[model samples]
Target: MSNDNAAPSSSSAAANGSADSAAPRRNSKRPKYSKFTQQELPACKPILTPGWVISAFLLVSVIFVPIGVASLFASRDVVEVVDRYETACIPAQNRTNKVAYIQSSANKICVRTLTVPKRMKAPIYIYYELDNFYQNHRRYVKSRNDMQLRSNSSQDDTSNCKPEDLINGTAIVPCGLIAWSLFNDTYSFSRGNESLNVNKKDISWKSDRDHKFGDNVFPKNFQSGGLKGGGSLNESKPRAGGSHCVDENCSSTNFQKVVWEDRGGSQQR
Candidate 1:
């Protein structure tokens, strides 16, 4: 009862529909070879074969191996000196109770003499290396008023500098645990008999002088004899209303320092 002509027509229509569903389209991800595109641009494609790679590596090695060896030999001439001073400085009997001895108003001076084997170069650095010391303690660090230290107007600003902040009623200018616990220990260098002249001009950063602290700011009531913290500040000079020489030392002698060394190998206490 099916017509052969109708069957052929249905089959042709199905084929036509399937073809129309998806017209021929190029892949989006695959690069097109257009004249303006880089894929079709004229370029030198240097093929790095195994032989080429090996040759390049060999050439680099040949140039660098001699240079590296020479550099190693030159570096051998440089030497670093690390002299242990704690054991040599502290007394034998007081070793048991070092805290008591150090805290007490007792003379704690020790000297060491060293004979140099080789000539030390110029621009040599001398620095302190403390053992069993915590410089980044929470309580020690946060006890500072940046506002008080920076400007003369903010001299009364002692919110952060507690305990050591105010003496009686007056606020300490450089009020903080860090400033209070400055380096009491001093280091000086001498060669033969002539004492070496120290250049402390570059001890602090230029930015600290220019930005961090104002020229008008000066020391107020640093140590009021309650408890002498560490190093003494030059608070004798009176501020004369302007950017005169402010008597305040902000060098990190213990915590951070890289001082110019004297022409000697000995480290004295």
Candidate 2:
């Protein structure tokens, strides 16, 4: 009996061991939140009250009032003279001998009479405005190579300028759309029949380096000279019917100066 009892106890113990081995143990540590759900862990919320809104509005008004007033004063002080002569001038051939045609032709001359309504402070600034000319066109903007400007060498990738950038294994100096389509427009200004002097020097941006010619290039390689048998790179001509007087001084007189041509006209302040 004792032997049989001992055998049953050993089998029971083996069975208990197998059951413990088969059962899964619970982990003591907790899992961390995923990066995706971590953002939700932080809780911050702002509640706006009527008093706070009023205070913000008052602060904005206090800051903006002076700025607005200064801007208005500055704008009022500036005198801008805009003459759109390109669309104003009617061709001589289009005019007839009739009185109405003669009157219409007279109206074609763009003349703006300016009388200062108030006494503005000394050193009043004047600016001339031009319209209908797009310098930011895709063809005009992408016509230059940044590498050529920065590195003094043509870019191996000429995708920006394409066929125009490369010629005979040489990169064109100042290669780009702006240089390709140069603004050839010229203007003349006058104050009360006396022609005003226009200072053309330093009119262009200083960033346009003169060293674009590079050591290997010559002055004749520009638009004036024949590059690879091409007569001229810039085909645009200066519009006729305007007189350009450079570096001339004029007498002070207030009268309407007629700008008869399409080139951006001059202004007298």
Candidate 3:
């Protein structure tokens, strides 16, 4: 029984070894990912910096601000400088010297001009002063003096001052026409007030020679010397026409001379 058992065990071991050797060796396969080409990111582009923009703006301001300021100041100075010859120039140009001093204060502007002379006095035409409402607070003053007149004429005697160009016996040389035009233009620019009609040519002056051009207006309560018209100086009780303060003889008063008034609240030129 032992021999039988031993023989069978040896035969089983031999069979198992044969079975193990007969089986084929198999290798395991691994899972694989898809094959694709990788894409590269694009390089960043250069952008404008905030600091550069700010620096450019600052540079422009530095260059232009001073020039703008200088130009403004230069124009102001030029206007003030030209205001010195109000009275002297009018008489020198054979034109009458006109003065307009408004009453009281409201809407008041002191206007004066240098009248351009007649044909005999050509080339000596002095443009009347054309000041309007103040542009700035900077005042300009010119005092009364004969020296400011620019004329080589020995007939410098301003005794019987001629009225501004007016309707002569036959000729209609409008009085204060040029001066009125200038005053209107300048006043409009300075004040921008449309109602202040300083340049209206339609309005008539009651008196030509005796009538003064102050504001180119007649005082409401004022009476005119009757000469022809009822409320006119020409038809006053007696003929009060000729010129301001001149007697019926039309004698030369020598007071007809124009003198510059105060400027900047002080006398100058």
Identify the leading candidate in terms of lDDT.
Answer: 1
- The candidate that wins on TM-score is 1
What is each predicted model's overall lDDT from 0 to 1? 0.63, 0.44, 0.31
Question: For candidate 2, lDDT tens digit of each residue in 173-252?
Answer: 54444444443334455768898565433232223323321222211123432332212222122111112312222111
User: What tens digits encode model 1's per-residue C-alpha lDDT throughout 1-269?
Assistant: 46978998999999999998878876699676787776566879999999999999999999999999999999987766777877678899988988777778888877777566678887566655656655577887788777765678988998878778888788886687766765566767777897866544344444555556555566778867568776655544322222233325333321111111111112222
Please state every model's RMSD to the true fold in angstroms: 8.2, 12.1, 29.5
Considering summed lDDT, which 10 consecutive residues are worst modelled in model 1? Answer: 255-264
Displacement of residue 269 (Cα, Å) in model 1 is 17
Question: For candidate 3, lDDT tens digit of each residue in 1-269?
Answer: 89989998999999999999999977657535434323334658667699988988999999999999999987654422134544543444333424421111234333544232322322211223434544233221111112212221311222222232222222111112111111221222122333332332212233423333221211111121111111111212111122343344321111111111112111111
Cα RMSD for predicted model 3 = 29.5
- Once fitted onto the true fold, the runs of candidate 2 whose alpha carbons sit more than 4 angstroms away are 1-31, 34-37, 40-44, 90-139, 145-177, 210-269
Using TM-score as the yardstick, the better of models 1 and 3 is 1
TM-score per candidate, chains pooled: 0.62, 0.48, 0.18
Model 2 alpha-carbon miss at residue 213, Å: 7.5
Q: Is candidate 2 or candidate 3 better by lDDT?
A: 2
